[model samples]
Target chain A: MSQKSFVWFCLLPLAVVTTAFFLLPMARLVVAGAEGPHGLAGYLAILTEARYRATLINTVLLAAATTVVTLIVATIAGMFLQRHRFPGRAVLIAMLTFPLAFPGVVVGFMIILLAGRQGLIGDLSNRIFGEKFVFAYSIYGLFLGYLYFSIPRVILTIMAAVQKLDVGLEEAARSLGASPWAVQRDVVLPALAPAFVASGAIAFATAMGAFGTAFTLATNIDVLPMLIYTEFTLAANFATSAALSVGLGLITWLILALARSFSGSAVAAAG
Target chain B: MSTAGHGAAVRIEACGKTFADGTRALDPATLDIARGETLVLLGPSGCGKTTMLRIIAGLELPDVGGKVLFDGKDMTSVPIERRNVGMVFQSYALFPNMTVADNIAYGLKIRGVARGERAARVAELVALTNITGLENRRIDQLSGGQRQRVALARAVAIRPGILLLDEPLTALDAALRDRLRSELNRLLRALGITTIYVTHDQAEAMELGDRIVVMRKGAIAQIGTPREVYFAPKDRFVAEFIGAANIVEAPVENGVLILPGGRLPIECGATTANATVMIRPETIRVTEAGEGILSGIVDSVSFIGDRQRLVVSDASSKPLNVDAPNTIQARIGDRIGLSIAPDAVRLLPSEPRD
Candidate 1:
């Protein structure tokens, strides 16, 4: 075959898959909403209702909190893993990234086992407070579950970035009369900014779109993903559920775009 | 600035280091660098020259053998940051995240110099390195030569007691290397800073150093001025490493050394009956009369820039190199008489260590 035909042949399957899975569904969603009784009313419903508004707020807050917490814990852990030659460093890294391979539902279950009424920390809290502490039944529980998954993702990404950083920069800083802490603060931390931003954004997006963990840990907490599931299953509101999905996707896209822009500036400044 | 008559003297006595992988990186090295003198540690790779520099800079601690002294004060236990020694790395190691001004001001800032003082110091260093206009440029924007100069300026900005340079010119091209080498020597001399430069380039050592310490296998092979080390090498390795030499097997009898094709008289202060006679390539000349030690045929001739090199072969085809000025008209396959001055021929001891 000619080169043009061969190139077209190579892209045909990807085009067909993208159309069938992504483009067609998105087109149908847009058209279906337009065809609804109040045309565009369903999309407005997501922003108008107090419950939906609360869900959106909770989604954003939880994602932001998880991102911050994950970034702090993961960056510290990754730096420690990078700079120190401590025993069990390899094992620690493997264990930290092990959660990335786990299913979200499984991670939620593990969190429940550890922070539920009868679990290890749950038992200690119960004994201390003289009551069963239900960490699996609140917004706090969703955060715990999200953090369980987000921490590993952040750690792996930031660790790869840290490992790739030129070590001579730190040595130079130290030789230039910078103390160890100053070297880390002035040289190492600034160099890791882009990676930190990218990883934090990824963790935030993952936490926002997470459904299985939120569903498994939901009690009275109404996050966006759980609310959409409730709209689809109990309220029989597929149109509104699709609208919420679209909203979450757009929010995630906006955040990821902002992160990309920030990281691009960071890389340019570093270069 | 003090404009003191003497700089700080560094003394490293019997320092040794062994890595965790069982490789002895440095083994019981002892050196004393005089005030305001530039010392070049010359060696091939894995010779511990860089390691010694790192040890002096307090980046690496020697394994409990001796102490490092600066100006007669012991600083063996001091940390790198508190040691107040400047270092220029082979990679330049310019901070990519900072501008050139910020990089030069980094040490001053860490030392808690006030803002005005730090700025003044940075400005002074930029001017000293002739990069005053490039201060605001990021390190990535600067050329290799600019970056190296910035590194040198940054190193000297803190007014370090001693400066350590680890093959700083090896990364540059040949032309840049030569230019920077001369510039570096001039700067160091003008600053009058006690400096330790580590390099494998003998020409750089010869040109830039007040004293050259040739190292081999983590030990000092010889330490002397360039002229002392070059013309009066203490061992065969030093003689061969410093320049190209013609080493021939010779037996000493009655204070005369016998070669394969002829006999030559030499002195080595030893009574060994067997030795190797070493003569510099430029020392051997072609004479018109056959009154010299060896008569040979010119096997090959090649022209260097200002000189011509000829390889002379005897009956047994043992080759000896002869360097002559380009003014001489010599040809291949010409029968020639090779003359060696008695003072130019030195006897290498027979029982030489590898």
Candidate 2:
């Protein structure tokens, strides 16, 4: 084969896989979203209907909260971990990032084990306040689970960025009469802006569309993924579930694209 | 002046640095830099010149019992932010996110100087640094020389009482470095803000410093004017470091230096049986063979544009590096006589231990 043909030949497998697994399913889902009794207007029901709209808002707010809290916690921890040396620092870092090895369902179960009706928080609250402080099967539980997993991803990215930061920048800022807080705000944070956007986008997108965590704790919550799960498996409403899935994917993608553009191409493809 | 009479009188009293890992970067030594003096800390890499600068700049605290004072006020416990200093790093350390204008105005903005005043100061600095038309450019968009200019402009924008620079021009190319050296020298002189510049380049030290502090192995070797250090080095290291010098270890009798090639006179009453002599290459004049005080056969000749360097053997204990004028006619294996003025030979206090 000639060079051009050989290059095309090397890309043939990728093309086949993309068509078979991604493009075809995505097209089918889009078509399926419009194949209901309401026809093309079925897609509009995602926003026009109260229950779906409420669930969409709930999902977005939860994801946004998760992204914000994760970034703050991770940035502090990552900066501290990167700058200082102490005994057991290696072990502490390893333990902090251990959640990266876990699936969402596992993270949800771990949250339950810490805050469920028979869990540690409940036992303590029951003794002190005469009431169990259970919050496991609620949106709070899902939020906690999302934070657990999101923090590690953001922390890794932030730690790498902090490692690459030049100490001279901080020194120069201080020499110019910038206080410690001002140095952090002006020099350190702005330098880590790209890392924040990249990792925060992944955290937001993951929290938006995550399934197993919401599935495990869906009794008192109405996240989009849980609603879609119920519509598909419980009610056997395939078209509505497919439409909601497309909505979830579209909102996540839109937000990620906005983030990437805002950060000037710093964001990678969202997980 | 050994010490300038005016900006901020800095006293580093027995300041030393021992990192937490127990590596001693600087020995306990005291130094006083006078107001408005541009004192250059000159040394090789790892010689603790930068450590001393950082101690004075308040970036690093000295070991116990050490103290730093600025204008009679103890500043050892004060952090760098409150020390009212301006620093320029070898890396430039320009804020990449901000435009050059914002960066130059950052210190003023932090001081609560109004936006209008900040802009005025930034504009004044831009003109002074010769970086016009670059106010809106980001740091990453700048070339190395331009970035250097921006860094310097940003550093001086604060009107700091004491300026601390750590190899500011070391990152630029040689030609750019040379040009910026004179420019920086002029700026420092104009500002007269008690500058502490740390560099490993001797030419930079000579060109900019009111006094050069030569350091080696975590200790200061000598502190003197450029001419003093070059002509009358206190030790072998300072003699070899400041400029090219031929150290001849030979017996001395009645102010005459006895060499392997011939005996030469010096302007010192050195009655010692053996003396270490430092002779600058340029001070040794090339004359016709058998006519001058010392003679040697040229081993090799390198015609550098302004002068020709001849490595002549049999002239001393070591092969002498003789810098003859380019107009001289001499080749390898040619016998030549060297005439050095009596004042050109300096008697070092000790021999080389390393």
Candidate 3:
């Protein structure tokens, strides 16, 4: 075979896999989205319909909150873990990362065990306030479950980034009469911008599309994944579900791209 | 230049450092630095020079009961941010996230200086440090020398009371280090700030220090002017550390040192049978065989640019090093006479090595 044909032969398996698994399904999903009664406008139904629009907004807000909170908590924890050495430090780090091994359904169950009617928080609140406090079946439980899994993922990235940080930078700032808070604000956070964008994007995207946790939890929570599942399985509305899935994927991709570009500019300006 | 008078005298009284893991980094030491005087802490790695510098800078507090005073005011417990001291780390420690101008202006900004004044100060420092047009460039875009200049400018821009430099030029190449050494000397003289410099390089210590403190094993071995330390080191460690010295152990009889090569006259009142003496290489003059006070065979000759360094064996217990003029012609295995002046030989008390 010629050199070009030999190169094509080398790429044959990748080409076959891409067409068979990725391109074909994506094309079918798009076509199926447009085949509803409303035609291509069916894709617009995600935004125009009140119930679908509420779910979209709710999911976006939850994912955004999860990203912001995860970054804050992880940055603090990672900095402390990376900078100090105490007895049992290795064990503490291992425990913090244990959530990464668990599935989303398991994380949701853990949250229920903490805050459900028969759980620890309910038991404590009952003794203190003479009333049971339960939020396991609500959107709050989903938020907690998302936080449980997101912290582990973000904390590891932040710890690695913190390890790469030049300690002299902080010391130089301190020598220049900068308070501890000012040093973190001006020097450390800017240096960690790339890491924040990378890990935060993963967390935001994960929270947006996670279905297992919502399925195991109450079905009444207004998340985009739960709405799509009901439309597909309960109502047997194939076109609407396919359109919603495409919308969800597109929105997540667009937001992630926007975040990456923004962080790219920030990193360049920082340098 | 008006800020020169604002320099604060520093006193470190009974300062020592013991790490949490039980490593003694610095022994209890007392030192007084005059206002506007440059003091250099000279030692090898793990010798506690950096620990002493950190103690003065308030980055690391000394052991309990130790006190750091600025112009007689107690500053022992004060944090570094409130100490109003400037420091230049070995890595230069220029903030990579900020431009040169921003980095220089950051300290002033933190002090709540207005935008207009901050810019004026930045411009003045940029001009002083010869980094004018490069102010807008990011730190990573500059060369090593430029980064060093920026770090210096940033430290001095704040007009700190005391400037503490911890091996500031150690990260640069040799040629750049030499050039920057003189530049830094001139800058420190111009600023006239009470400065404490730390380095393991003896040449840097000799050139930049008003007084050099030679340290060993977390304790100060000797402290004196460069000439004093070089010619009159108190012990063998200081004698060998500051410069090359030929330490001779020989017997003293009738006010003369009896060596393997020949007898040399001495001035110190040493009636002991055996005594140790230090003689510098440059002080030994190479003369004709059997003519000078001592004679030996020239084992090796190295022709350096400015001088010829010769190792003459059978001179004493060990071979003696002699730095002769480059113009002198000498070959290996040639018998050479070495003459050292009476004042050039120093009697050192015998001390056990650690």
- Candidate 1, residues A1-271, lDDT tens digits: the string is 9999999999999999999999999988776655555678778776788988888888898999999999999898887787689788888888988987888788778878877766788688777987776778677888988888888888887788888878777878888888888988898888888888778888988888888886666634688888878877998877777787888888789877877786776677665
Question: In candidate 2 chain B, where is summed lDDT lowest over 10 consecutive residues?
Answer: B1-10
TM-score sort, best first: 2, 3, 1
Q: For residue A8, give model 1's deviation from the true position in Å.
A: 3.1
Runs of candidate 2 with Cα error greater than 4 angstroms are A265-271, B1-6, B269-273
Best by lDDT: 3
B128-243: candidate 2 lDDT, tens digit per residue: 89999999987777899999889988988888878889999888899999999999998888787899999999999999999999999899899999988888898999999998
Q: Give per-residue lDDT, candidate 1, residue B249.
A: 65
Q: What is the TM-score of each candidate against the true structure?
A: 0.95, 0.96, 0.95
Q: Write the per-residue lDDT of candidate 1 for residues B216-335, one digit (tens) a residue.
A: 888899999999888888778888899887777655777766666576666643445557767898998777537567788788989998999999888223599899878877788877
Model 3: CA > 4 A from native: A1-19, A123-132, A269-271
DockQ of each: 0.71, 0.57, 0.70
Model 2 has an lDDT value of 0.89
On TM-score, the candidate that comes out on top is 2
Q: Ranking by DockQ, best first?
A: 1, 3, 2
